[model samples]
Target: MNKNNTNSDSSVKTVKRNKTRESLPPKKYQVLEQDWSINQDGVNIYGRLYLPQNLPGKKKAVILSHGLAGNYRDVTKYAQYLAGQGYVAYAFDYPGGAKNGCSTGVGQLNMSIFTEEQNLKTVLNAVRNRSDVDRYQVSLLGESQGGAVSAMLASKYPKEVKSLILLYPAFSITDYAQVAFKSINRVPDTLNLFGFTVGKNYFAKLFNYDLLKSATKYNGPVLIMHGTDDIIVPETYSEKANKKFKHSKLYIFKHAGHDFKGKYVTRANRLITDFLKKN
Candidate 1:
């Protein structure tokens, strides 16, 4: 595996990794961090790559995607944890994914689920092409809006994506958009959504895309996690998704809201690790 922070590809620039100390991986399976960035359609999508430095042989990979108005940091903890478990974990910030994202070009006004889907696709291609990664074993771990994107991609690339993991997916986006705007003609140039200002394009392809229906196309193993107390996206959505997938399991965390916190975080982490290990 390429351990040094250098690459010959002009499109792939390797930058300094973070040094903040926390939980370290096992001595025999130390983890190495790298700052990775790729340009897609003039937009610079930035992300961090976590590799098990000492682990031998090709490793399975997991791409972690964040939710709406959220950046790569939202999934960084999961990435780090997964990396410690001998899997290659990548966490990236989608262009226009957040008000303040590491990626450049495209603002929130031009961002939409479709655009984010394209960004995730780009990340998937980049990660799969890595020399040390097992392309056939690549999995996707998406949170909220990202989960919806992962589902769509997994459906499209069923053979490539080995497994799927959704964390409180925003499968209700289409319903919420239709009810809020009534019609596309009523969509304003910009509007406040869940405390974030976004453009009408935010709902551009939602009306046509059937997330749950499309998600059912992927025949790989699927793991869906949701909070029992989640109001933003009720646990019922996940329950329905669990039923839609050909092979899937749904776990509900009691008292956990849209974002898992406190003891729920530990439970979620453990659950995710266990799921990935099994699949």
Candidate 2:
């Protein structure tokens, strides 16, 4: 009887250990980074692709876009995290997207949202064509101006986009442009705004495009995140944009500003991971 009892206890211990091991998350795959160049209409758009090592099969992919005047490095952390999670991540710079970006500089003097959208499309096409990427599972993640561009792209190509994640999207660009130019017809050839020399084409394009209307066309799963205290892009814009999406979730970080950091970034990453996993 004593021997039987000891054997039963050992069996229970082994079962419990196995169960615990099963409950633990899988080990993260090693990530490799590579530089890629995507040509849009003739301009070289530079980007970084994050690939997971030791993956058994092709994985889902995400194309990340930086905010206005920002480069691919701005979203490197997100790319790294997604790559670790077994998703191939790509971050690209729009032509003249930033003053110091790696892409061919069109200069802020001629940069416009329409041009940026074209660049994004080029990157998406390049990503979709890669054998290691699951074309049907590609998603877009954009910040600020890039968020607006992503939303527009998803709307324009609903069937191609699996999901969208917009962080503090600048949906009020047209409204802000109206305020800056006073009269759209009177926009100068070049004007300075926020320390950047923006061209009249930028304001003209914003005046003609309706971001909210374009966003309404995309009915895919959308994740919109904003900071309540963000002065750059008001939380209300995100709130209003959320109402347009057929399937959308809005997260407002308390006291968080336009840029996320520290605990806030961690929180955002968690929310993003959960959303991606579900969709």
Candidate 3:
């Protein structure tokens, strides 16, 4: 990205590549360059390590996963805030979402729900094994579909992820597809003519993800944020997800839409701050 129109590169890696814009509020934090790569499975993943000046101790990290079509900078604001609070926040762009600096390809996993899971695992592994900080204290924050995958990862590997902050995450892929179909042309019923039974295109993958089942299995604390007027992801879905969580809390933004901003953003940030501090 052109320096005039983008955020600066502050990762821990020695190599230079696509750089995500630093989050808003501009915390006095520097990004420890990153080592980017696409795994053998063709999942695109990259990590940006952030280090706080004069940190109290070896800083813990927050692995941030972006939304569909969004990049690592998508959550720069949150990452920056975490950094200000003395956490080494790492944000990586995942395959099937936005390709910041990782390999790319077309495959069943990339096109289906499987890509999200694969990318999440790859990113988490990358963060945990990094040389700069403590990985055991690592946590996750995901938006939209990323939220769903993160939830599944936390449930499947409770020993790895301590907690989760899901922002309007898609718990039901089928629900997302159904809402998507309303705006765009609906997929033809015969599209899955071949013995396959899933909806055509994205809908086909939605059937593969079962977030409710995953959440039920996750025994960690979950903070679910959703806008009451989120047309893309109805708030009701979050309501249902909240019930599935044994140790979870929900924050509804009245009159707020998909990506809640203004007050919603402020409160959500505070919530994360509290969760990380207490836990």
Q: lDDT values of the candidates? A: 0.80, 0.79, 0.66
- Per-residue lDDT value at 172 in model 1: 85
For model 2, state the Cα shift of residue 177 in Å.
0.7
lDDT at 193, model 3: 19
What ranges in model 2 sit over 4 Å off?
A: 1-27
lDDT of 3: 0.66
lDDT of 3 at 18: 18
Instruction: Rate residue 66 of model 3 by lDDT.
Output: 73
All candidates in order of lDDT, best leading: 1, 2, 3
| Candidate 1 lDDT over residue span 162-274, tens digit each | 89998999888887877777778888889888888888888776666676677556778888888877889987777767766777877776667897765665666777777
TM-score winner between 2 and 3, please give it.
Answer: 2
lDDT by residue (1-279, candidate 2, tens digit) is 443212121110000111121222333988999998876656898889999999967789999999887789888878888888899999987786665788884666778878888788888888988999988999999998899999988999988899999888989888898777677688988876655667877877666667777765687888888887899899888877776677788888777788776666666677778889988
Candidate 3 local lDDT, 1-279, one digit each (tens): 433322122111111221453233444555444445546564455656566767555557788877655667778778778887778787776654563434365332234445667677777777778675677778889887678778878888887887788888877665555565643256654333122333344455444445566554676777788877787678777777776666677777667777756556666787788878776
* Model 3 regions lying over 4 Å from their true place: 1-44, 99-109, 176-201
| Candidate 1 local lDDT, residue 272 | 79
Worst 10 residues of 3 by lDDT: 9-18
Candidate 2 whole-model C-alpha lDDT, 0 to 1: 0.79
- The window of 10 residues in a row where model 2 has the poorest summed lDDT is 9-18
